[model samples]
Target chain A: MERGGRFHTKSAELLAQVTWEVAGLPDPEEERKRQAAEFAALAAQYHPHPPLARNLIFAFLVGGSICAIGQLFIALFQSLGMTDVQASARASITLLALGSLLTGLGVYDEIGRVGGAGAAIPITGFANSIVSPAMEYRTEGLVFGFAARLFSIAGPVVTFGILAAMASALIRFLVTG
Target chain B: MVTGNAIAIRQASKRLGHQTMRFETAPAVVASASVVGLREGQGPLGRYFETILEDERYGERCWEQAESRILKEAVNTALGLAGWKEDELDALISGDLLNQISASNFASRNTQMPFLGIFSACATIAEGLLLAATLLEAGVAARVIAAASSHHEAAERQFRYPNEFGAQRPMTAQWTATAAGAIALGLPADGGGGAGWGAAADGSTGEAQLLPRITFATVGKVVEMGQKDPYDMGTAEVPAAWDTLLAHFRETGRDPAYYDLILTGDLARIGSEIFREGMRRRGLDVSSRHMDCGVLLYRPEQDVHAGGSGAGCAASVLASYILKEMRKGRFRRVLFVGTGSLHNPVSIQQGEPIPTIAHAVAIEA
Candidate 1:
């Protein structure tokens, strides 16, 4: 009786296989893909969209304000009889120092949060990117922690910035010649 | 037509089905403790926590050390509440969200108990509870401690950015909670209470019905459906949670209505909504009784984005609010489903999909 039951189940499975082969139904892989796409769409519906317009306005205001502050510093230095180039350089240095000081005081991050890329696209943001990692890794000791990680975030920016500057200089040299 | 040997084997088996385990004697959770940092202390469930630190550092030198210190404090506090000495525990099962589970290992070092560190990401506490209950039921141990913790700054530096690095987090991003929780489980006094068996010193009677018992556990398989977003872990974790919930209900011959509450660990807002919709599509409406630890941890104005997450998110909620409410006879039965995203920074950077898991433990008051 058990052998007969097993034979009956085997026949049923064979019949099902034949029917599946002949039915021209969607293949298992295609079915799986369709299900996955459907589920992904379902999940994506719930994801909250970030407020892009608000963020952009905030970034513009903050970035413009920083640049305005830099201009004020440049004007003050120029009033002291410095050259235009020297005044601008001094303003940049002053902004970097302020950024580093704010980061050390643990206030720049809050500014970054509010300003979005506005605070981040400025010289102050660059200073923050470098100083924060140094402060965070200081616990790993001065050598391996602070000094090594000082350039961890800013290293990419410096490397790429120098490369791009060289490329621009080459382009200018070729065009002028 | 079954043989006597076959009948004995069937009767002796602890497994209900393929994934669920039923203990012959359920282990009682005698005591539990939760410790949280300042941000979580200011959250909605803050008043329920045993220890709330004004400083996230907890007088420690670094965030990692602070996490370990809080975990140790939670374990000690749980043991103190249970009126059990450190020597009374046979093993400590704990894990945390750090490389090599460093926080748990450092915490366990001070515990001086036989340690078994586990990792299933945020599902760690449920995994630990399952193991502890299994150990107690199997007569391997009389008393055991299960704990998990996660620190926001420590995890952020390891997984995303430096604490002071100013980057705008997306709305889908969850704030990793700086919290720790520990639960002490032991065999019922009537069953395996050997030499050190005694009523808890908390003035409760020694009756088993008075304490919440870890009755059943359903182990989950890793489910990956090509979800790759690290910022949106709630969405990544929903499939695994749904898979585990389905398996638990099917294998255990139970339904959504079997438990008074179905608590999901850190599925937050988006994930919970997705989970409910998925369950509804499957003819099971769990919306009425569902609660998420991530959603419960913080208020909308906390700027936690989606919600709070981490191993400690669920652990702290369970050890504090859920269990406390259970003790007060508010909830009679609970299905604690811990959802976890098992992806690291390297894996995420490599564009690999997040493999997630969920472990469900049934607890009854």
Candidate 2:
């Protein structure tokens, strides 16, 4: 059977074919898909596209500043006689704490609103993803609410990270052997 | 189940055509009250709300509890304004944007009145009003209350991310209003007083023509145009609103000029524009007389994106601004089209397209 037709024409035909319809008729699924496509085309005209250039500039500045702050913490820790790796680890921990603190104080979301992906792509964003849900679900109780939901948003990241690491280890072992 | 008395007293058919129902004995909206959180209280319609809550939690322990408390407060305030006690009310119909509509259930539990819980997402207020008006006209009840509510924090947690979660919303996204509204409807007092049970303080009938009455209602069908973007619900809901509006116009033999104003529930910016374009395509121009509660609730500087939404968007606006203006003779006839996107978080996650519904209720003074 012929399956392609404009939505208006198909709909008009469908309306006319409302009787009995035990015989030849256009496929309902095809009609639905056409109608959906038609409506989507119309609706797309009214949907406003986000300003990508402005968001990119904001993200670059804000994300660069966060990294600069991380570098500052690393330098400070190294000045306290810590090794390079130890200083880097300590800086990460400090940033995580800062993210959690700002999230608790209800300020990180404001930064996110202005910074867009800049606030959402850093180590601080990871902390926010975990802490925000924990605080939101605290009213449900500690066991099921706080603990269970603590990683609800960040669980995929951890799970996929471990899986990717294992896969890479297997690939290295196979290649080395 | 049709007894002899049931058949004998059954008035002429109230069903006007396919979708519209004409209430022979129109129910009077006796009283209404709006209670909103600080954000909505600071919006454009702030001055019209009955109570502006300084605290979003309303001194409650949790956000869910706060939602229930606001709903209860709205119901109580409406009852108080109507001068009716709890026992005097016949039934309460209420809903909210929550899992299982727990807000309305908990609020009804506190009221201790016969309750019927309903859910139509944002269109719940109009659904409740239609049911309440039907109960009054059916001779089943004398007085009924219809209410709906939504909380920004509570709905955000359920439908999207946590309130404090850092994420940028798209321009098409609408902010769920933290508000609640309740309205009391009852049979008009005898002698065409136009005042409901408690309105005639001195037993004077001078305000006989002032009361706004629910005269017609059109129940909408679920219309799915396969729109799947959950963040862009304003566009998703336009087709349903258009369907119901067309059905109402066809069934009642009325045009856009029949009513002084046409109010849509929460179609916000894009949806309202699309609706107007669709109507114009059909040779009906409702641009001048049409307004959306979502657009009216907030100012552009409020940064609500598309605008205010949720069950409370329509309910709060209707209970406060629209009815108040109607009472002041600003509009004599109004058509309220409450639009709702019926997709849940689970449905959206399942990759199902969004389906929408709209219910239109006609009110006249």
Each candidate's TM vs. the true structure?
A: 0.90, 0.91
Q: Write the per-residue lDDT of candidate 1 for residues A47-72, one digit (tens) a residue.
A: 77899998999999989999999999
Q: Give the TM-score of candidate 2.
A: 0.91
Model 2 chain B worst lDDT window (10 residues): B190-199
Give the top-scoring candidate (DockQ): 2
Cα deviation in Å at residue A34, candidate 1? 3.6
Candidate 1 lDDT score at position B263: 97
**Clashing residue pairs found in predicted model 2:** none
- Reference-based lDDT, each prediction: 0.89, 0.89
Best by TM-score: 2
